[model samples]
Target chain A: MAEAREPAIRTRGLNLWYGDFQALFDVDLDIARGRVTSLIGPSGCGKSTFLRSVNRIIERLDYVRTSGSIEVMGQDVLASDVALTQLRREVGMVFQRPNPLPISVRRNVLFAHRLHNPHGQSRAEEDELVERVLREVLLWDQVKDRLDSLATGLSLEEQQKLCIARLLPVKPSVLLMDEPCSALDPEATSAVEELIWELRGDYSILIVTHNMAQARRASDECIFMLLGKVVEHAPTGDMFVTPTHSETADYIEGRYG
Target chain B: MASPGGDRSGPDHLGREWWWDKIAQVLLFGGGISAIVFIIAIFVFIAQQGLGYALVDLDLATYFTSPEWRPTSEPEPVFGALALIVGTASVTGLAMLVSVPFSIGAAIFIGEFATGRTREILKVLVELLAAIPSVVWGFIGLMVMSPLLMDVFDVSVGVSVLNAGLILGLMAAPIMTTIAEDALKAVPDGFREAAEAMGATRWQVIRQVVLPSAKNGLVAAVLLGVGRGFGETMAVLMASGHSINMPTSPLDQVRALTATIAAELGETARGSDHYRVLFSIGILLFLVTFIINLLADMFVRGKKTAR
Candidate 1:
């Protein structure tokens, strides 16, 4: 787990602002390939801001502005010539609350695939792709018989898993999740944490969590941030045991953020 | 429980608050039910005025089937309204054809693409366009569209189906745009965010995700526009030539049902068959519009429950 590897996502000199309020300041990180990294910070500490800037989804708000260099899978994602659609295809995202489209499960799963491949494919091939992703997320059996049903009908936990599953069909190398389990119950939270753990080493997962225990157990590397600045980046155990910064120790010990 | 003042304010000001609350409840209830009361009253009045004459005296078959609408004929009036129905149908149909695409496009542009100030300005402009009186629209149709149609299509009559339809379509667009934009807006922002994150382009998100989710509301928008077209009197009466002819072509002169009632109702004697027939036309318009409004309301409700 501690092996030195090439980085999948490297952000250097990253700074972001939302209409004059700076949310992220000089965020620099080199997240290793095929590892689950957790970002832990108090609310409005720029943890989610850092995650969103990776895929540039933060740009959806016109007032948001950034001065940064973000590279995903060794490609300079922030380059002017880069197509956002292609960049997003390579780097998928899961939201805080499961926001599945108001469409059938099958269609939601195939949405990206169809967008990239506008020409038709065989029905059997689509079914196979759908099954493969759902199986990867350990959701195939629960949703096996109801592939055509609306995705919104599924439970929040199932919907969260489906959100992850939908991204796999597009073969995104990096996955960014922002508070994926915050909306779930304690049981469902652990269940989804287990799914995230199983997804490790296959996709580079960058997850933001408010649950300190989830960060301790479910992640390989941990990042602790405060006031839009990264305080510490270490293996989860080391960060929890002997953090390099006072803010990190206080946050980890249930003291002040 | 120990606080007697908390239990009542009955002691405060000699229960003035309680009396006011009771008065408010009664007033609010009356105000709310007044709409229903008025609608029922109007329907009953319309029925009383027209139902007997339409059922017993008028020739139902001829009124529906024949195109001859000579209500003031010497010995015996024909009372056929087939031509007027066709006239209204043709104009409204053409108007729909022209308006639906434009309204949807405007809605997409405003709801999806335009940002803060531009979006607000466009909305204000749409309302401004809708604010122009129908009579003023009629004037534009008669003066502007009429000549333009005659010159472009090599037709003698300017106030034909083409002229009236163009005017009505323009008239109906602002309302359709407003409602369609609302439908588009009702689609949650989460859906757009999820789709866009999956690399769906702006247009793709609108067409595949937003439009499907809001289809019921969009259809309701179009239906309301159709109802507006059906009930419109001044514009169609002024723009559409009030000739009693079954319009066979876009260039052919026609008279709408609304235009006929508006044009002839004033001249007819109080209890004459012609006056009674106009009231009957009112009933038909009422029923058509009532159905359209009901369907639109149902569609809006369907959207609410589906979500």
Candidate 2:
């Protein structure tokens, strides 16, 4: 039924190496457009590496080698001259640590735009963009007046929201979140999960999460991996209630991570 | 005699405790008095010898303002302290100008970035620099750096303020680097990681996050270095040329107060006005060093409070 829809990102025979140690084996996966896909796996599994490869973030690490192709919007990102900065702007990320800039909240949001868009938007336009993104993240009310305050001074949850706001100003086609709620409290976690759910209509998102419940609650499609290889991929409801793979079933059932 | 075993030691024990307490008290008092006596004796000696000329003959402002060092023929013998003051101030100032950036930069490089064997090598280098005697450094400045600089600048005479400044700056660099690097390293890694994750380049992270967070430590490093520079006498004396005149140019020969005291005290006849003038220079040196250390302490305290 979902075959008609375009796949926003596609990975084929993807393998990754950190020097002699291979972190990821050959893997093939398709992430559909306008959906939240959560990569769920045990620790040291290639789920995060796979997600990073989708946007070429792992390539930034020294001596990291990857085989096969990650095609973003049907263009082979690995093969082409697509600049990492340009790709990063199109495929923005929110890290596990709420990595807010040391600068003010306003500048944090504006920084991506400044680097990616050299034409330089007007001050009014940038301010409006910051406000709009902050509102989308449900952070505008808390940060609307004190946009100039240092981003680090915010509470952990607000800092995460500020990070999301920062990513949105770049207008990414797909957003990658690497365990974004890992540093947040339950209330903050719910807020972020809700934000992701609300944002599903506008952008394709691939979230790497260990929280099984979060994957069930927020993702439309789920991919389960064990030891750096994708074990199963299916619709979230079926993947959770009746997993196709025994390892995935065991993982989802809390038998083993 | 039947019950004496438990009770006969009372008087001796009490006396022993009392005697020990008395000895401890005497030692503490003696130590305190020794420090005070030494300090007071130096001040009193300086005052006893130099006070008459400073108060009666020479005006207070003139002593600080008059640049002429010669006391040849005036009835009052025109003994102004301006040459000494300017000489000391200029040497210290030049030392700071050379030391500040080099030390801070070296410190950041060693503390923040270097690793394993490379870091160990740098550490050893710093330790070796520190272990070298100040007097030896002074001699080196006199024999090597002073002449080299004069030749490089193509001046007739060597051993000027410039030579002193360069040597002092080089000597102070390792000390500053070690202190500053330790301070920078003490800053948590979280700050740098956060900055980098925000797409800040390495230099930007260093300038904005790392430096600002380590501001207090950097200031303290500079303070420690400045104190070391101020107290460095032998090096300044040997390389500063001991020319009683003000430093008119980088090549011009000049004398620091430390150099003047070292050079003139030998030639002057005992109890002469010139002998007393050398003593006055010592007093001035003491006062200037005291003021600088006090300022540095104040700076460190102010920074701590700000943080």
What does candidate 2's lDDT look like per residue over A33-67, in tens digits? 88999999999998888877777767556679989
Expressed as tens digits, the lDDT of each residue in B1-307 for candidate 2 is: 5243434655555555577999999999999999989988988888788767556655667668887776555565666667766776677778889999988988877876676688899889987898888899899987888668868988877787788888888888888888788778866676665445444456766887788767777887887777777667789888887777776777666677777777778887777777777777777767766776677567556645543
- DockQ winner: 1
Identify the CAPRI category of the predicted complex in candidate 2. Answer: incorrect
Top candidate by TM-score: 1
RMSD of each: 2.2, 6.6
Off by over 4 Å in 1: A1-4, B1-14
DockQ of 1: 0.88
Query: TM-score per candidate, in order?
Result: 0.97, 0.78
TM-score of chain A of 1: 0.97
lDDT of each: 0.92, 0.80
Which CAPRI category fits model 1?
high
